[model samples]
Target chain A: MRASSRTPLTTRLWAFGVWSVVIFFVLNLLGLIGSVVTSSFATRWLGTWFPAGFTWKWYFAAWDEFQLGDVLWVTFEVVGWVVVISGLLGVPAAYALARREFPGKRFVVLLLLLPLLVPSVTYGIPLATVLYKVGFGGSLVGVILANLVPTVPFVVLVMIPFIEQIDPRIESAARVFGANTFKVFVYVLVPILMPGVLAALLLVLVRTIAMFELTFLVAGPGSQTLVVALYYAVFAAGVRAVQSIDAMAVVYMVTTLIWLIIALRFVNPTQIVARAKRDTSH
Target chain B: MTDRGPTLTQRLRARGLDGVTLLVLPCVLAIIALFIYPFLYGLWLSFQPKDGTTMGNYDRFFREPFLYKTIWTTLKISIPVTILNLLLAVPIAFRVRLMKHQRLLTTILVLPITLGTVLVAEGMLFYFGPQGWFSRTVMALGLMDHAPSITHGYWGVFLSLLITGFPFTFLLTLSYVTGIEPALEQAAATLGAGPAARFREIFLPLLLPGLAITFCLSFVQAYSVLPSAILVGDPANTTRVISIAAYQAAFEDYDYSLASAIAMIMGAVQLVVVAAILGARTLVYRGPVAAAKG
Candidate 1:
C-alpha cells in the first residue's frame, strides 16, 4: 500500500488535506479536554489563557458536593449487573441464532434490532413511565433494567458473529462424545467463547457507563450514574464552582477512559463498524 | 432405541425448537417485557388522554407550536449534523484505510465516545464559549477582533453533535472502506484510471450502501440529542429537540400520554428517515464485497 514514491501529486495532496483535517480535529479535541483537566485543578480560571493558580480543592469539593462516592458506587453496581446479565441472556441467544434454523428467525432478528435502531430517548420515556408504574422507577434496579433494553440486544448482535465464526462441528463433536447440552456449554463452549464474551461484556461496560438517556430518565436522587450526575451538575451550573464541575467531568472522563482502553485491547473499533455493515446489508 | 421414549430435547429438536433454541427465550422475553411491552403500553396510553379522547395527545402536540416545532428543530440539527459528519468521515476514512498504522488514529478519533455528550458539552462550554481559550487564542492571533459566542446556542449544540458523531461515523465508514478489495483499485490503476477515476468509479459505488447505513445510524444518534441540547443549546428556543420535548412532558408536566405521543412521533420520524435511506440503498450497487479484514 506504500506506493507513495510513485503516487500522483493529486493523490498526495488529497492525503495531505485529509491528514490536515484529522490533525486539526485531534488538536482541538485535545485542547478541549486539556482545558477541562486544567480547570479542574485550577484555583481560579476566568478570561485567561492559563489559570491564576492550581489546587486540588475542587476535586475534594466536587467529591463532597456531588456525593460522588455514592454516585460512583451506583454507577458501578448498575454497570456490573448490566454486563453480567446481558452476557447471560445475550450469549445463549446469540449461540442459538448462530446455530439454529428456526421459524420466525428473521422476525426475531428484527425484534432485537428494533431496540438498537430506535434512539434510546424515544423508548426511554415510555419505559421510564412503565417502570414507575411497576414501582421500580427511580432506583438502581430500574436503572439496570432500563439499560438492559439496549445492552441485551447489543450483546446478542455482537456475539452472533463471534459464535458464527466458530465452526459448528466443534459443538456437534462434543455432543457426539456424549456431552450433554449443559456440559458442552460449560466445558467446551465457555472456554472457546470466553474471548468474545469478554469483549462483548467489556464493550457493554463502556456503553452502560456512557449511556445517558435511559439512565437519566429512570434514575432518582440516589440512583444516578456518573454520566447522569455530570449532566445534573452541568445543568444546575451556577450552584457549584466551575472548577468543581470540571473536576467532576474529569472524573467521569477517567472512569470511562479506563474501560475504553481495556475494551480496545479486546475489540477493534473497526469490528463494530464491520458488524453494523453485515447486519444492515442483509 | 425404539424401546426408550424420545427424550424431551429430542422431541423439541424434531420440531426445530431444540433446547439450545430455548436459550433464546429468556432474552426474547426480557425484550418483550422491557422494550416491546412498554412501547405497546405507550401506544395505548397515547390514545387514552386525560380528556379520555383518542388522538387527544397527538392533537395537542400538533396544535402547540412549542411542541410541534421541536420536530422541525430536531430535524434541522440532526439532518445537517449527519450530513456533515458523513462528508468529513468519508474522505478521512478513505485516506486512513491505506495507512499502515490505522489503530492509533482510529483510537484517537474515538476518544470522545467515552467522554459522553455531557463531558463534550462541558468541554465545549469552556473551549468554545466567548471567554474560552478558542476565542482568546483567535483574538490573540488577530484571527478575529472579538471572541465568538459558539456555545449556549444553536451552533454550540451543532458543534457538540459534530464532535461526538464524527468518530462513530468515521469508524463505521472506515470499516466499509476497508472491506472493499484493494486489488479492485489496483486493477483500475492498471487499466489507466487516475486517482479521481478510481475513487469515483470504484470506491464510491461500493461505499454508497454503507454510507447510507452510516447516515441512518449517525442521524439517529444526533436526533436524540438530549443532554448536549439542553446544556449547550438554548433549549427553550432554538435547540428544543423532540427528546427534550418528550422529557418535559413526562417529568415536568406529569403527562405520560402526551410524552408517549411525542415519543411515538420521534420514533416515526426516525423510522421514516432510516427506511428512506435503506430504500435508496437498494437503487445503488448491491453485490457481495469481501468482508473487512484487520
Candidate 2:
C-alpha cells in the first residue's frame, strides 16, 4: 500500500503468505506461555490480562520462604545421573542392535521396544517394592533406576535407526589394514555416532528434567524434582488463593522454555534416522 | 594398530569370536529384568493375598468400587483427547505439504512433543492460571467475568492433555502424509475428483494405517498421563487416573500386592482396547495387507 499506487498484489501476498500462519500461532502460543510468568508475581490481579503490577515476593517466597533450592538440586541430581547412566548404557546397546545380528535378532529388537507399549505404572509399583527390599526405597537412586523404564527405552529407540547406519565394512576394512577394535570405534564409530548421540542425549536430558510421576512416587521429600515441587506448591499451598504464586509458575515456564529452545536448536531428529548406514546408495 | 603376541590357538579363537553373541548379552538381560520380569512380578503379585496365597488382589481390584471408578476416569480422559488430537493432526499434516516454510513450521509444531507431560502441565499453569494470559484475555473479552480456572480440575487436565498430545498425532501423520506420492493426487485430479474427493478416496485410504498407529500412540500417551492429571485434575471429580492409584496403593498404603493387582488391571484394560481396535481396524480396512510394506 505504501510503495506505489499500483503495487503488485501477487508480491504483496507472497511476502505475507507464509508468515500469516506462523505469526498467528507464534503470537498466541507465546502469549499463553508468557501469561504464566507475568501472572506469577502480580501485586494484584489488576490488568485485564497481565498482573496490575509486579512483585518479587513470590520469588523470595519460593526461593527462601519455601526453600525450594534443595528440592531443585535433588531433581537435577536424579536427572543428571539418569542422563549419564542411560547414555552410557543406551548408545552401545543401540550400536549392537543396529549393526550386529545373530539368533533371536528380531525378537530381541521387539523386546527392546516392549517397554514403550507397557505402561510405566505396570512396572512402577513392583519396582518400588523391590527397591524397598533392596534398601533403595524412597531414595533418589531408586527414583533414577525406576525412571529408566521410560528413559532407556526412549534413548534406545531414538538411537536404533541412528546406530544402524554405521557401516561395519569400514571398521572391517580398517581392521583388515591393521586398525584395532578400540581405534576403529574411536576414529570411525565415534565421529559417526556423535549426532545421534547428541540428539539422544538432549532428548534424554529434556525427558529426565520433566520427569514427575516416577520421581514423585519413588523419591523422598528431599529428592523431589521441580515438577513434584511445583505440584506440591499448588496442591499443598493452594496457588489459586495467592497472588505472588504466579511468579513461581513463571519460573517453571521460563526454565522449560529455555531448555526446550536449546534442545531444539542443537538436537536434530533426522540425525536419529539418518544415522542408519549413511545413505551410501545415494 | 598395536601388536599383541598370542599363541596359534589364541589367534584362531579371536577370529571365531567375531560372530559371538557377547554384545547383546547384557542389554537383553537388562530388558528382561526391568521389563519382562516386572510384568511377571505383577502377575505373580496380582494373585497373592494379604494373608494367603491366592488371587485376592485381582478379585479386590475388580470388586472395589473406587478402583472401578479410577479405570472409568482414565478412559474418559484418554478417549476425548485421542479424538480431538486426531482431528487437529489430520488437517495440519494435510496443510504441511502445501506450505513453503515447512521446516520452520514443522519444527515449531513438532518441538512441543519433547517437553513431555510435566512441562505441558507447568506450561499450562502460566497459560491457564488465573493470572495467565488466556484466562485474562478471555475474561477481558467478556468471554467470562473472571479468570476461568482451567488447570486445577478436570477440565484443566483435559486441556493440558490436548496441548501435549496434539504434536504426537501430528508428527506421525505428517510422516505418513509425506510418504504419499504426488502422482496419486495428479491422477485423482485428472479423473475429475475435487480436492476433498481426492483426499477422501486416495489420501485417506493410504493414511488410515499411519493414522491408526498415531491414534494408538497418542491414546497410550494420554492413558498413561499421570503428572498432568495429578496437577490439574480435581480429586473431588474423581479424576485420579490409574497411574496415581498405583502410586497410592504402593507408596501411601504400603500395599505392594494390591498395587501390582491394580497395575495388572490397567495393563489388561490396555490390551483389551488394543485388541478391539486392531480387530475393528483390520476388519474395516483390510489394513495389514496394504501397510505391511511400511
Best by DockQ: 1
On the 0 to 100 scale, the lDDT of residue B195 in model 1 is 79
Candidate 1: residue A250 Cα off by (Å): 1.0
Model 2: per-residue lDDT, tens digit, B100-205?
Answer: 7666666665545654566566667667777667776787789799878777788988877876677667666676676676787898889998767898888877
Superposing all C-alpha atoms, what RMSD in Å does each candidate have to the true structure? 2.9, 5.8
Candidate 2 clashing pairs? A36-B126, A40-A246, A40-A247, A41-A247, A165-A276, A165-A277
lDDT per residue, candidate 1, A148-243, as tens digits?
999999999988988887888998999999999989999999999998899889888988999999999999998999999999999999988999
Tens digit per residue, CA lDDT, model 1, B248-291: 99999999999999999999999998998898887776775444
**Reference-based TM-score of each model:** 0.95, 0.84
Best by TM-score: 1
For candidate 2, report its TM-score. 0.84
Candidate 1: which pairs clash?
none
DockQ of 1: 0.67
Candidate 1 error regions (>4 Å) = A1-6, A272-282, B1-15, B286-294
